[model samples]
Target: MVQLSLPLKWVALAVYFGTMSTSVLAFPQYQSLAGLSERELKEALPKLTPRLPTPPPRPEVYQGAKLVDDAAHPWRAPRAGDQRGPCPGLNTLANHGYLPRDGVASPAQIIAASMAGFNMDLQGASIATYVGHLLDGNLVTDLVSIGGKTPKTGPDPPGNGLVSGIRTHGTFEGDASITRGDDYFGDNFNFNQQLFDQLKDYMNRYGNGYYNLTVAREIRYQRIKQSIATNPTFELVGHRHFTAFGEAVFSTNMWVDGRVKGPLENHVTQEAAEAFFKNMRYPRGFFRASKPGSATNDQLQFVLGTDSSRPGHFPGKNVNGTNSFTIDHSQGSVADFCAFYTYFVGTRIKNLYPNPTGVLRRNLIINIEYFYGSRPPGIECTKVYPYGQL
Candidate 1:
């Protein structure tokens, strides 16, 4: 509301007029500097085009289902303590010469014996694939009985342990990458060495000095560490252990043809079979596909031979034999779930954990392993090995 003198008003008017004149000349001057005429300037500007988002590519589908072997492949020599002999579970079978007596109980030997029993061809197959089939396809049972005590109490609560400190038996195939950093397991819980020692003992006693379950377990654990360093999504939480602490995995069986004349025929029910695997636990190990072009890496699959060809599948011996195997908790003394947890899931990580700081992490891992073990098998077992007495 202040009044200004006439001279000041005239000065203000001159400034306003100068500014307008400059703005009007600005575009023309810019055009001149750019060496473009008005028409050219308009034409030089880029045309606006509507952009559309691109659709994501579909996931790769694996198709190789045929099993093949490579005759040129050389057999790997067994490590020390791989000599085969008698074990607690199958002394009767070994004494009878049903299973081979010379080979070590290592992964390769186990594959050879299992393939021979199943009538699968493994002449040229990669020994790795053979191990995968034997581990994934077979059902391990403990003929030992638990003295009226449950080994496991319940699923591990989240934030308490990685995957709830529980484990399942079988292989889960997927594109495992190291970049993921095994963060899928949440807290980092190193596998316990003491548990491995116990596993070694299991090998000496049950494996007859031929197979060292602990060594095999450690090898797989190392492989997983390497895999995590290389792959992006794959991370190992824990592995399946046959001997939950000192308790035996009891009765180990494979999915044989239900029609095959064997001692395991007509023993398992669909309900019980489903229930057992619903909470199945497995030890850690590296597995590869015998056949290529398939989802042979991460997804879990459980299989067995059944009595009849259920539907469209071929009428071969039931891969899911009705009574392929049983864990006669009633036979010998079996350990309870708590002991099983201690050895399989808890011990490996718990014992090796950095006390206090890793305690929660170890618990978390145990929980997660248990969670997966309680679920049905999702990955199908592929035949990639041959059968031979070990």
Candidate 2:
């Protein structure tokens, strides 16, 4: 277990597993949905936690390769009302109707689509969806725009509150993206051809015509270096440190056709990369990954390996001058898995809904639990309930 700076108190217990074995000291067991609440706090909260949406079933038979962009699922440009964002995977799914063409989807819909379209494992997709939805989405309606903020995600809160959708920078979307530019340099949602070209350059030199973990590590650092030199507000602290690398690894892992397996497991080719990054189209007869996959800790290690140059926990923002970074790992660091969790739930989520109550509060806690269970590489930390149990 992670030795959090503070001791684990009695407000809430770690609730990741399905069943609890034995408890020690004041700590208690939080099992399933039924155990989350004493009584339905509101009609919205059937239990203290909402039931997670079941992912779409994988086909029983693997017929050569199942075409995700098949006749039934045709690629179409997003209409004016439909949303698109930094996540090209979601955008491609929407283009082919794997998800709703409108781009506004519930956590359940998102989990289902990610599974069916990209074969992203339910755990991986849940980790992404809950964090994205809770922070940038509408908790009341359980809807989030895959692109820029839209009124479709229900009414807004008073004051500085923002239901800004997935495009809201500093939440899940952050700097050093594989295909998108930093939000500090303006429009971060749409594909930036310049940034993508840089990715191709690194891929040519590193992967020799393919996008893999090696290329991802180099390109990720290069992109960050670009941001630090160009954008004065470049910051890679907190969850952004994780995303900085995770996003690139995700592209390499998920973008390549799962049909091309064995020796070429995680290799994404040029023709295929262009289809996803530049055009948001699946290559001809594109098939979902042979199985569910995501940027797990093992995959992410490629980015945070023993390379002395790579910033592990020493992620920081440019102080003032170009390339003048002031390293700070105060909140957390990518090198420490539990430290990442401490920063994510304790800092980010806590700050977002400090005074949440009723349905709003209940959902936040449940979603936080989902994030806790996402389990990055060496996550052994106890869940932090920033807002103590009411």
Q: How many steric overlaps are in each model, in order?
A: 94, 0
Q: Top model by lDDT, which number? A: 2
TM-score of each: 0.19, 0.79
Q: lDDT of all the models against the reference?
A: 0.25, 0.69
Query: What RMSD value applies to candidate 1?
Result: 27.7
lDDT of 1 by residue, 1-390 (tens): 989799999999999887765543322110101122334334322221111111111222431221111222222322342221112212212222323332212223332332332222232112222212222211111001100011222221111211111111112221111111222343122223443344445445544432222323333334333433443434222222212111111122222122324543322222222222221111112011222211111111111112123221111111232222222221111112333333332343333222322222332332233222322224222211111111
Error of 1 at 214 (Å): 27
For model 2, how does the per-residue alpha-carbon lDDT over 1-390 read when each residue is reduced to its tens digit? 755443343222444221232211111011111111233223224322333433323433432346787899999988886778888888988999988898878777888788888877766787778767766775644567787543322221222233366787777888777788888888777888888888888888999889999898888778877787888878888667866677777876678787686877789999999999988889988888877677877777767777666543367888886677778776565566577778777876666655666656666676676667666544578768886653
What are the clashing pairs of model 2?
A: none
Q: Give candidate 1 regions above 4 Å deviation.
A: 1-74, 78-335, 342-348, 356-390
For model 2, the stretches where C-alpha displacement exceeds 4 angstroms are 1-65, 150-163, 311-313
Worst 10 residues of 2 by lDDT: 26-35
Model 2, residue 327: distance off in Å is: 2.4
Best by TM-score: 2
